[model samples]
Target: TEADPLADAVAAAVAEANEPQPSAPTGPPLPGGEKDAFRVAVGQCWNVGSLSTDALGTTVVVAVAMQETGVPDGGSIRMLSFSGGSEAAALQAFEAARRAIIRCGARGFPLPVEKFSQWRDIEMTFNPEGMQFR
Candidate 1:
């Protein structure tokens, strides 16, 4: 089966956000430090039907949460929260939760990549099942 474009985009975005930084010098570790906190929780379940129309919606929700909480990197948050930590880990938890929800939604009902071009044309509905002329 072909990869879902929306899911691929979201995964790429999250991966980019979580990429390791090379410049931070080793020093006295930050107080209350922990291991990789960024991750998607598996046991927690969600109804994909409740998520927005596409992965973009999910990405937006995650980005907003990250902006609000100030942790753009997902791994740190995943490790701290799911691994057992504080409520301070809630925002990260939300991000992971939203992403998972969207991912599940995408898996259950994928959007077609061909629909992307429709955004440029008002007449285009981006409906894959719609009629095509010869």
Candidate 2:
């Protein structure tokens, strides 16, 4: 039997429609800023200097939740995931990130309110090897 191009096209269209669509940004995103600056700001607010060299290679993903008024939930910093290094290292990294949140203060996270919507539920991956935002 010959191929049915119409059937193929219909199937493709249906498949595309069924595919999960990316969610729209909850709020406007902030204009591009230096990620390094953001990292430095957080680093300054917390102390993670005691971790051993091995732990320094770990990366932890931290999620911060914000409220409607642009205020972050006081205890919303959560360890979503991690990569590289041992479990202990990952735990240390997670704690460090949390401490940064606590110490930095949600309202002073170095992000403008203009970007609050986008970051209301943002996850930040912190790599300890170089303190870079991945």
RMSD of 2: 7.3
Query: In model 1, what lDDT does residue 33 have?
Result: 18
By summed lDDT, which 10 consecutive residues of candidate 2 come out lowest? 21-30
Full-model lDDT for every candidate: 0.32, 0.71
Write the residue-wise lDDT of candidate 1 on 1-134 in tens digits. Answer: 99999999999999988986544323344222111112212112332333333321321112211222222223322322222323434343455454653443333322223332211111101111121122
lDDT of 2 by residue, 1-134 (tens): 99899999999999999886545464555655644566577766656577767668888888888665545576777888888888888888788878777666666555656655566676777776566343
TM-score between model 1 and native: 0.20
**Stretches > 4 Å off in candidate 1:** 1-60, 64-89, 92-96, 102-108, 117-134
Give per-model TM-scores.
Answer: 0.20, 0.66
